[model samples]
Target: MLQSIRSASQHWLGKIVLSVIFTFLIAGVAIFGVEEFFRGGSSSTVVTVGKTPISAEEVRTAYQNQLQRYQAQMKRTLTPDQARAMGLERQVLAQLVTEAALDQKTTDLGLAVSDAAVLRAIQDEPSFKNANGTFDRTLFYQTLQRAGLNEPMFVREQRSVIARLQLADSIVSELPVPQAVREAVHRYSTERRAAAVLSLAPSAAGEIPAPTDEELTAYYDNNKASYRAPEYRSLNLLVLEPEALAKPEEVTEEDARTAYQANQSRFGKPERRTIQQISFPDEAAAKEARARIESGEEPFEAVAAARGLDPKQLDLGTLAKSELFDPAVGNAAFALEQGKVSEPVKGRFGTVLLRVTAIEPGSIKPFEEVKDEVRKEVALRRVRESGFDKAQDAIEDARAAAKPLAEIAKERGLTLATIPAVDAQGNDPSGQSVTGIPDKETTLPAAFRADVGNDTEALRTKSGGAIWYDVVKIDPSREKTLAEVRDAVVQGWTKAETDRRLVAKSKELTERLEKGEAIETLAQETGLPLKEVTEIGRSQSKDDLSPEIVERIFTTPVGKAASAPSGDGRAVFRVTAATMPAFVPGTTTDGQLVNSLRTALADDVLGEFISEVQKSAGVKVNQTAFRRALGGEY
Candidate 1:
């Protein structure tokens, strides 16, 4: 069942099972003579591992799930070409092949789950339980039906999954990590250092002379790709949102009244009372307590206090009549006047005396009082429920009839937005950000992928809207003339020259500091400000020191100088001190680091085990079948 699968995915055992399966499936197993595998005739089987065959349908299903996951993560739809370029098809095939190899190995080893064990696993699943916490046969069957599985199929799949898990656990569970390994990791993560740093600004390079026309032209030629334009598409988009389409003015009085009458609960509040009660073992005890309160020998609070119940324990807060679990107690509580206590009443749990401290009478707004609000609600609901679908159908009909999107939008009183030109990143030719594109993250990618005059599916927006777009024209990418980008070329040439000079200058200064020159003396001579940074960790970066500089500092030995590129300049740093903090045992941090190392070690062992299994069993792929599974030609 889908619910059971989801619930299992969150458990530790389930995570391990899934991790092992996916690890083998997508580990990029080396295939020998791949081209020869494509020479065979087409078959429904995509791969064969030992005696087991992996069907193309299985690969197709796995690929589609993988594709949907990727789309969800990226929040955008990918075209077929994009998917292929991302090597999704190859990954999917490799995953299935590896899984099949493992399954074959499990079979050879005589690993199997008993039918009783499979039944127990299904019965133990929380998703199949009823309200009383017992497994429900109807719920179990219904869940399997929704998941498109029969009892036999589900039981078989469960058996296979458990067998695979057993194989993986035998290889990876209880694997030990060495104490030295934990110490090494801790030292690397906890080491700290101090450094003397001097920042070199662009001015330190000292005025890069203007480039010659020839030099600029040479730079432009070398970096022509940087100055080239990206392909752009001009699109006509028609977006329909329910809220925007809803016309409150069109809603009649009759319609508003009908909606108001149909949804009375939405326009009114039920009467509520602040009540409290004290339960007794029997009706006699409840009556005795009420009699004592009535005789003024003890108040309700005193009586509750005598029973060792606090005010909070006695108070049930405010509630409507339907909120009370016991109808007898609810009726008695509501019938009592404010500041009055009722006689003993038999409730579902036991006999109880009820008290009402406050009452709030329910009220409903008249139709005339909420006419406009009701009308707006009805209009929006209509558009959301049915109007949007009808409008989409009409637009689709027009599109099927070969009518242009812009004309159809105009005829339907919808806004037709025309993007003059936009690139894959939603940027115009001038590199300015384009605005007003609905669902830009999903739409732009789909638009750039579609060809002019092609029928493309409408994209759905996050706000429950649909966007239909037509590619009007596509501008092919081309190299810009040198004259057209002269300014950018000159700027690039200057920055490159400046960086070269800065590197040389920093190298010269670094050598002097490393030899014998004091950092303060060099700072005074260069007229650059110098600062000392202390307690810099391997993972930390300061405002003046970037992560790269921090890494350089750690790599440099004490009393040595290193240079790294900084923001628009360079920084020469000298290591002044290095410290390795004492590693405390049994701390939370130490435990976490040890556990992570253990997990990594286990993964390595598991990977090696699977690799050996694949080698022993022998794996073969039918490249033609694999390609066909992805709807592609070999």
Candidate 2:
């Protein structure tokens, strides 16, 4: 059954529908980008799914939507060339063809959505709701208008969408996993294995002696391409940030006290109580219930149950002083100690009988404990609210005059620093980040755009400050001279030789184990970190033991030796025991496990089912029309 599902879903359409588009539609919101074509002239059909034509206009809209989505997600505008490079045009066209094919198949199967169902689907869309929580006709039309869609076009699209969903639901609902498959999955999930593992660390490689000059020279020559230095630029930076401008001395004790007093919610909260109560029709009945609890004739829960109120229905959980709806009941309840019953108190709802189950005492941070932090927060907020005026002023002056940023720094009382040769990623030759450069989020793109000899226009930063930079020098990337990276090259060569030796050592150890040498005895002889694991389920993961070793232990037969690769070298393990728990029928735990496995099996089957439908219906694409709509020849 699993193999059949796997075979069915191997098609491209199945992969796109099950793995890719489902996520794209849910989170990324795939839109129709190339909608402009639909408004003007009639174009050639780009694809045909059965008798339905997916016009060039629809394909164009999808491509445009995809382009805008990419730009928004990446936070960088794509040039026309970049957009073409992504192959989004083909991806979007194929998606539209899949939708058309599904719609065609659903229509042939008579799975049409009724008019009322379409109305419900549209109104249920939270986008069409107003503050009143009902569909607003004005908003409905205005939103579609903003989307470059008319009522007719949008309604048609929604109709197709709802019908396609109906088709998908039927496919998912029809597939079922066999009983044997379910049992097989249960045994796979619950089975455990035991093994003793001999860990081979880099130390096991045994202090590999220094390499010969000929070997070192050959290693460097063969790997020269990987030794090239990245392209780097020298930069002069001028920056202003809100936190940097906030002087600690400017903040006084009075300011911190005032901030702490005004923003009490941030520092501490009042005491909260968890309470339960039952409303009564009259004061007499409420008083009677409270009296019964006070006399121990009945507990609060007993009284609540007698009144047809469930414990959960009566529980209000924990709430702060101001959260209560009735001040009379709240004041009375807060005054009572835990396990004490409050007297009947008249509230907005009715006469209520209340009991406090628990209380969390309120407390405030001592002034001295928070003084320094409070003062700094107040001063920084004040500076940020002013929009970092000093930085803005200095940046405007530099941009208007096109003067070097370093000169502007002196005039504005700001610090200016030069970052020696650093790569486009802001890493210096040593591969550490270049210090004193502006934050990478704002600087990397701007630095790339700036002319080599000219200062950039002031770029806005998240701190509401501005930064200016100049590209002082550009060094094209190239292979570094051997003298420049001799240490790094030697380090790399040593590590590679060590790994090779480790593999050989691990193989030798495996051979000994296969020859009846106990793993624990071998560990003491070789000085490796030795350990044993028993009765651990296949799905269990361990931090100390590598998952690769656990997997290999389960796959190897009892008494057989196997080796699995680790970060340093390898784990040579011998399986001692294994077991598969028999699948018991009708138990709730077993049923739940079987159901979970069936859900996955159903999805695989459904994906295969959809692909078969698409193929049987037949899909064709018009190369010329598709190329024209996408604005390219593929």
* Top candidate (TM-score): 1
Report clash pairs, candidate 1. 25-95
Report lDDT per candidate.
0.81, 0.73
In candidate 1, what are the lDDT values of residues 1-634, reduced to their tens digit? 2323644545444465455556654545444345633444338887777788888888888788788878887766766767777778767776676667778988998998888888888888787775334578878898888777898887877787778778887877777777787788888888888889999999999978899888988899899999998998999999988887888999999999899998765778978899877778898888899999999989999888876777887877798887776688888988899988899998655677888889999888889999989988889999999899998888888889999998998898889999999999999999999998998878997898789999988777777788999999999999999989889889999999999998998999999997999999999999987999998988687756887899898889899999999989999989999988787777898888877876777666776776677777767677778788778843
For residue 151, give model 1's deviation from the true position in Å. 4.2
lDDT per residue for candidate 2 within 400-420, as digits (tens), equals: 887777787887688897887
RMSD of 2: 9.2
lDDT of candidate 1 at residue 136, scale 0 to 100: 80
RMSD, one per candidate, in order: 6.4, 9.2
Tell me the lDDT of candidate 2.
0.73
At residue 453, what lDDT does model 2 achieve? 71
TM-scores of all candidate predictions against the true structure: 0.76, 0.62
